[model samples]
Target: MILPIVAYGNPILRKVGHDIDENYPNLDKLIEDMWETMYASNGVGLAAPQVGRDIRLFVMDSAQIFSNMDEKDKEEENYPDAPGIKQVFINAHIIEEHGDDWAYNEGCLSIPKIREDIYRAEEVTLEYLDQNFKKHTRTFNGVTARIILHEYDHIDGKLFIDYLSPLKRKLLKRKLDDISKGNIKVDYKMSFSK
Candidate 1:
């Protein structure tokens, strides 16, 4: 089941969600659908916020297909190409963060067709639970680093574009304004000052 993804102007995308006490009814199904959506859309990450859900959860799978320097996915990565598996995080919390900053190109499922170079911490240690409510702590770096960073922002009502320079922000202002005007289907009603 492919879930319906919200676009760039919807208000729900901006809301800071609360922790999930339990995997809500249909959560298992939603995870399945989100996995489908992420694969079908060529995205390594997908957030509940992008799908119009205000839950503190998201799914990430980065080893889908890595673009080769020679062609546009014309050849599969050296490995057999893992189609992508669903990783669920319900009511996740980041207990600590320790790392250097680095820049990498990133794209969003919600804001389609737009890619930008973004800087994020090189390493992060997070404590969270899966859909089954099992606790886990994982430290990730590099590409996986990018994956978790993107999804976590959804829970915090922040976007990768928010970390851009003032000049770039000004350049994207018109587009964001267009987003606010309903040109795109994103949810930007955020509240994360707490």
Candidate 2:
């Protein structure tokens, strides 16, 4: 099942997600649905908040980014290794972020047709639980880390647009309002503000 992604002005997107344990109802099903919804919408990452669930959970598949990059592009971007990561993160926390900030054009399923250049640390160390409730600490970099950071923001009640400058945000205000009102067409299912 592909759940309807919550639109930009939805209050749920601003709510901090709560941590959930293994016993959470329909855990596997929810993750599966998120994956389906994300892929259907051409997204590399999807957080619980995007699907109207205020839980600290997200899924990411950075393989597409890895596969799309040519050898020359990887070398030029200093992306020597592509982790090709595909995993679930539950109750995730960023332990540290280091290295120079790099700018990446970021977008969200919840805020379709909006992409902005966001600068983020090149690497991030995170602590999270996997699908089976197994705990792990991992470090990620390059495109993989970028995707994680984007989704991680969702659980923290932050959006990529929040990182933009006041002027930039103001410029996008009308488009954002249109999204909230369902004035734009999107290929995937979306729940808009009434």
Candidate 3:
């Protein structure tokens, strides 16, 4: 099912998500549904807060992207992690933000079709946990940088649209409201709901 992406103006997007714990229920299924919702909505990444969960978790899938590069090419390009299947990040922690900022065409699943050029760090280095709860850190570039940045925003109580200019933000306000209301396609109730 396509889980409803909490829209831009929603208060949940502005509320920092709380850290997850051991006693929390449905750890496995929550990860599964996040992957399903991400694919169904044609998103490469998603955060729990984006789905109203208020938990420090996000899911990412980078399939259908560059995956067959040779070792030499990967070394030269510096993008080695071609995402496999759907990976989950729980209790993520950003230890550093590095490199200069560059502008790219960015959009949000919550905002649907609206797209804009947003500046983000050219590269990022951070630590996050895999589905198995193992810790890993690596540099991300290009589109991966964009995806991770967007998901990080969910954890920090912010949205992509918040970075827009006043006039541009005003222009999107009504559309955002419409998307938040009921005009856009979303499925909040899942194969199971809490």
* CA lDDT scores, all candidates in order: 0.72, 0.93, 0.74
- Ranking 1 against 2 by lDDT, winner: 2
* Steric collisions counted per model: 11, 0, 0
lDDT of 2 by residue, 1-194 (tens): 98999999999999999999999999999999999999999899999999989999999999978787788877776673374789999999999998999899998989999999999998899999999999999999888899999999999999999999999999999999999999999999999989
Which pairs of residues clash in candidate 2, taking residues 3 or more apart in a chain or in different chains? none
Better of 2 and 3 by TM-score: 2
Clash pairs, candidate 3, are none
lDDT of 3: 0.74
How well does candidate 3 score on lDDT at residue 12? 79
Q: Return whichever of 1 and 3 wins on TM-score.
A: 3
For residue 124, what is the lDDT in candidate 3? 71
**Across residues 9-36, which tens digit of lDDT does each residue of candidate 1 receive?**
6778789977766637788888888888
Candidate 3 positional error at 188, Å: 9.5
Of the two candidates 1 and 3, the one with more favorable lDDT, higher being better, is 3
**Candidates 2 and 3 compared by lDDT, better number:** 2
Who wins the lDDT comparison? 2
- Model 1 per-residue lDDT at 64: 51
